[model samples]
Target: MARTLAEKVWDQHLVRKGEGQEPDLLYIDLHLVHEVTSPQAFDGLRLAGRPVRRPDLTLATEDHNVPTLDVLAPIADPVSRTQVETLRKNCAEFGVRLYPMNHAEQGIVHVVGPQLGLTQPGTTVVCGDSHTSTHGAFGAMAFGIGTSEVEHVLATQTLPLKRFKTMAINVTSKDGRLRPGVTSKDVVLAIIAQIGTGGGQGYVLEYRGNVIENLSMEARMTICNMSIEAGARAGMIAPDETTFAYLKGRDHAPQGAQWDEAVEAWRELRTDDEAVFDAEVDVDGDALTPFVTWGTNPGQGLPLGENVPDPEAIVDENERVAAENALAYMGLEAGQPLRSVKVDTVFVGSCTNGRIEDLRATAEVLNGRKVADGVRMLVVPGSMRVRFQAEEEGLDKVFTDAGAEWRSAGCSMCLGMNPDQLAPGERSASTSNRNFEGRQGKGGRTHLVSPLVAAATAVRGTLSSPEDLV
Candidate 1:
């Protein structure tokens, strides 16, 4: 049978089937936990008198509430501190390993998973965070779960789930390859623009075609991480040479002859040419351009050089009203060029763009330039590996010397889970995925951009492309 990539991997990991009585039992290969979502799950484990069925499969970290500036003291926000404390207590009680705040291994759960080689191809990964799709870069079937589901996995090391429909999103670049200036961010934003916010309902999107195959692993991750934002249950890229190369010698990747066997199995994890999809979408990679979000949702985005859409021109009254309100809250003028808009802060980290390539792209702009006087610039690595690499290559020095604050690895400002956040009324140009209201903090306006755009904006103190700095 011609099976989809998702199905190919899922079948390999299924421990039980969906009979008349229960959902399919999916054996999870990795369970990433963070402070905000793990306490209750651990407590549930204690109450149920169960130990983590496979502690080796679970990894915990303290983020979202960790202070990026000063890790030595108690967190100032009492609620956040309590959350972190609870996680520490829970990990201790369960005998599950944890990367505490400021520890070298501590960072965004999604980021640490990939960098440490925990995100293996053909694996099933789950987290309490929605962006777990980021691990799809390695050809894993990864998704986020709610608190109840989190507890269920903590107790059973498996999930009861109904299968998702398969979809193929083919990206074709008429020019034979992706354009020079456009990025994976542009590709995803272009997709959202065409399909709207709810396009991929009930489907697990599989990226295919020449353009998609050519994207770097990090780029592929950027595309996958926003699948949920497109209303897809998850997104995946078929395991390939690029995927194998990226996982070859990582800390957690399978080694020796076992690696060869793993690779052989992963090679079969592709959608057969004759496989059918419930839905399909095509994009011309050449048509893509650097993109920036203009409103509250990630879908409310436009090409960087494009103007903010005039809400009045929107035919749907409801969408128009929402746009109008978003415009007001964002302090943006409708119809104004998004690139010309002023920026108050520049953030270059998160699960989305906190890897080495992201830092290099940002550092390329920060080489000799300084962050604009009033604009606060933050550079947080996504993991200790990324941090060590950046520091070894002096990327940290470049950021600090460029006048941006270099923070420890964590999910800083990605969702305001930690002390790194935008204060009320402060607007920021961020590299994270979402731009929802209060996503960073109350009244904390956010504009999503590429790492290059983020770095350029930091120097210019305005939303802009790296070409402007060049």
Candidate 2:
């Protein structure tokens, strides 16, 4: 029978098929843990007198609670310190491998997995993070699970889940290629805008078509990382030569004969040509430009060239209300040019756009430029290895020379769980995924943007794109 990519991966991981309404039991290929979500799960295991069934398949890291500026310093916040310490103790007791703070492998769990090549095609991955969808770029069936599910996976190495409906999001360009300034970030923001936040409810999105195919693995990750923002269970891309090449010599990737066999099997993980999806959506890549969110939710975005929309102009009552509230919270007025909105800070790091490629791109924009006066810019790497790589490539110099602070890896300001945070009422142009209320800090206002836009914003002190700089 023909099957879509999501269905193929789901079937391959099923250990016990559901009868009637019972959920199917699926074997997990990888289980990712972090300081923020693992403590309670570990306690549940202890209370149940259970040992982790497959520690080898599990990986833990200290990211959410680790400080980025002075990583070696003792954690200042007691709550954060407790979480990191508890994670260390639990991993030691459970015989699970953990990458603690200051360890070279330590990073956002999502970034660490792909960087080490532990994320692979046709695998089932679960993390206690919404952005676990980032691994889906490798063609894995990855999604975030709740605390109870995390404990279940730890105890049994399996999770019970109903099958997800599949959706194909075909991205094409009018001229056969994207415009020079359009990036995966812009493409995804545009998608969210078109579909709204609830459009992908109950479905796994498979990104297909020429524009998606031409994107690099890092760019693909940036796209898949934000699937949850559009209310999708997950997002994925088909594994091809680009996927194989990225995994070729990484730490956990198969080697030699195993590599050949692995690639052969992975190549077959694609959706059959005649397979059907439950729904289909098409996005025009040519029409996309740099995109930025003006509201708390990701769906409230427009092209950088557009102006703030008037709530009265919206025909839908609910939409009009949302727009009105968003404008009030954002301190924006209807019909105001987006480019004129000034910011107090510019942040260029997050699991969504904190990879080496992202850093390089941000540096390219800031090479001979300086951040605008009164605008503080932070250039944080996603992981320590990414930080090392950036330093090796002199990207760090470019960032520092542009008056941006270069810092070690961790989630940093992405979630504002650690020392990095925005002051009350502070406005920022950030490359992070979500811009929800207090997502960066208490009462902080966020405008989600791409790395290119982030760097340019740092230079111009507004919600401006790289094109605006020229």
1-470 per-residue lDDT for model 2 (tens digits): 99999999999998999999999999999999998878899999999999999999999998888899777789989989998999999999999999998999988888999999999999999999999999999999999998889999999999999999999999998655789777899999999999989998899999999999999999999999999999999999999999999999999999999999999999999999999999999998878889999998999999998999889999999999988988888889899999989999999998999999999999999999999999999999999999999999999999999999999989999877988899989999999999888999988899999999999999999888888888
Query: Per-residue lDDT for 444 in model 1?
Result: 96
The residue-level lDDT of candidate 2 at 225 comes to: 96
**Model 1's TM-score against the true structure:** 0.97
lDDT of each: 0.87, 0.93
Question: Candidate 1's residue-wise lDDT over 429-454, tens digit each?
Answer: 99998899999988899999888889
Question: Model 2 residue 299 lDDT?
Answer: 99
RMSD of each: 1.5, 0.8
State the lDDT at 272 in candidate 1.
86
* Candidate whose lDDT is highest: 2
